[model samples]
Target: MHYVKSKSILSAKNGMNLYRGCTHGCIYCDSRSKIYNMNHEFEDVEVKENALELLKKELIKRPKAMIGTGAMTDPYIPAEKHLKFVRNSLELIYRYGFGFTCITKSDLVLRDLDLLEKINEKSKVVVQMTLTTADDELCSILEPNVCPTSRRFEVLKMLDEAGIATVVWLCPILPYINDTEENINSILDYCIEANVHGVLCFGMGLTLRDGNREYFYEKLDEHFPGLKARYIKEFGNDYSIPSHDEKRLMEIFKYRTSKAGILNDTNEIMSYLSEFPQKSVQSKLF
Candidate 1:
C-alpha cells in the first residue's frame, strides 16, 4: 500500500474513490484498461491520504446528497481492515447527515454494518455487489481473491434484513464459461431470495479492451487453456463480446427480476441510488 496527497475527493456526480487500483484479482476487471492511465501497479493500491479531509470539507458545503464510492476501486480492500479509511469516511458521512452507497465484493463490509444501518435510518444507503456466477467453485476461479458468490448472497440478505437497500451487478458473464441458463437462474434465485431492490444487467456479455483484454487472455491460458485462442477467434479486438445466448438469457433475467418486483432498468436503478430522501434532509433543518 502507498499513500499520496490527492487534489480532490468527490467527482462532479458526488462519487469518490479513496483508493485507486485493486487486488481482488478478478480475471476481468475493467479498471485495468489502459484508458484509465493508472501509473502504479494494478495491485499496488494507491491510498488517497487526504480523501477524508477533503470529503468533510465538500460535505460541509454541498447540499445533502448521496455520497458514493467504490466505482473504480473496491473501498473495502484488504488494507481497509487496518487503515480504516472507509470506516472513518462513513463516520464523516453519518456526522454530516449524508446518504451513502458503495460497490464491493468483500465481507469486510459487514464490519461497518452498524454505520450502514445508522446512515440508512437517518437517510439512505445502498450496497451493490457483483455476482457473476452462483457456483462457489466457479466464483473462486472467476473472482479468485474476493469472497465467493454464496458469501456475497449472505451479505445481501443481511443488508435486506437490516432495512438497507441492496443491488446486484450481474455482469461480465464470461461467454462460454458462465453464460449457461443454470448459472443465470441460480444467481437470480439468490437475488430473489435476498429481496434486492434491483439487478443491473446490461445484456449478458462482458467488455474487453486493451489492458484488461490482455490480462484476461493470460488468465484464460493459465486456467482454461485453448480458451484464449478461442476467444481471439471469436472476438478479434471487439470491445463488446455478447454471449451467444444473450437473447434467451436476457429474457429470463427480465422475467424473473420483474416477477420479483426488482428494478431491471439501468436508468431507473441509478436514479433510485442517486435520489436521496428529501424528507431526511428536511428533518435535519429542525
Candidate 2:
C-alpha cells in the first residue's frame, strides 16, 4: 500500500473511493480491466492520503451530505486492515452527521458495524452486498479468496436482524457459470428470507471490456475450458454478456423480487440509492 494526494475526493454524484485497487483477488473483477487505466498492479492498492482531508472540507461546504463509495475498488480490502483510511472517512462522515452507503463483499465491513449503526441511527446508512452464486464451491472459483457466499448471506442476515437496511446486488451472474435458474432462485430466496430492502439485478448477466474481458476470459479458460471461446464468438467486443437463458431468468428475478416487495428496476434502485436524504426521520418526529 502507498499513499498519494488526490486532486478531488468525491464525484459529482457524491461517491468517493479512498483506495484505487483491491486486494480481495476476485478473479473476475472488472476494476482490473484496462479501460480503468489503473497504472499499478491490480492488487498494489493506491491510497488517497489526502482524501479524508478533502472529504472533510467537502462535507463541511456541501449543502447536503449523502456520501457513497466502493465503486472502482472495494473500500474494505485487506490493506484496509492496516490503512484505516475507510474508517477515518467513516469517522468524518459520522462527525458531520451525513448519510453513507458502501458496496463491498468483504466481511471486514462488519468491523465498522458499530459506526454504521451510529450513522444509521443519527442519519442514514445503507450496506450493499453482491451475491452471484449460492453454491459455495462455485463462489470460491468466481470470487475466489473472498468470504464465501454463505458468509455473505450471514452478513446480510445479521445486518437485517440489526435493523440496518440492506440492498443486495444480484448481478454479473456469468453465463455458463452461475446463470442457472436454480442458482438465481436460491440467491433470491435467501434475499427474501433475509428481508432485505431491495435487490438490484441487471438482466441476469455480467459485462466484459478490454481489461476485464481478457481477465474474465482467461479465468473462463482456466476453470471451464471451451467456455471462453463460446463467449468470444457470441460477444465480440460487446460489453453486455447476457446469459443464454436471460429472458427466463429475468422473468423469475422480476417476479420473485416483486413478490417480496424488493425494488428490482435499475433506475428505481439507483433513484432510491442516489436519493439525497429521506424525510422519514423528520416526518416521524413530527
Most accurate candidate by lDDT: 1
Could you give candidate 2's per-residue lDDT for residues 83-170 as a string of tens digits? Answer: 7888888899989878889999989889888989888888788899989999999889888868998999999998987778889998
In order, candidate lDDTs are 0.94, 0.86
Q: Report how far off residue 13 is in candidate 1 (Å).
A: 0.4
Query: What is residue 170's positional error in candidate 2, in angstroms?
Result: 0.9
| Runs off by more than 4 Å, candidate 2 | 278-286
lDDT of 2 at 284: 54
Give all TM-scores, in the order shown: 0.97, 0.95
Q: How accurate is candidate 2 locally (lDDT)?
A: 0.86
lDDT of 1 at 157: 94
Error of 2 at 118 (Å): 0.8
Per-candidate total of colliding backbone pairs: 0, 2
- True lDDT of residue 241, candidate 2: 82
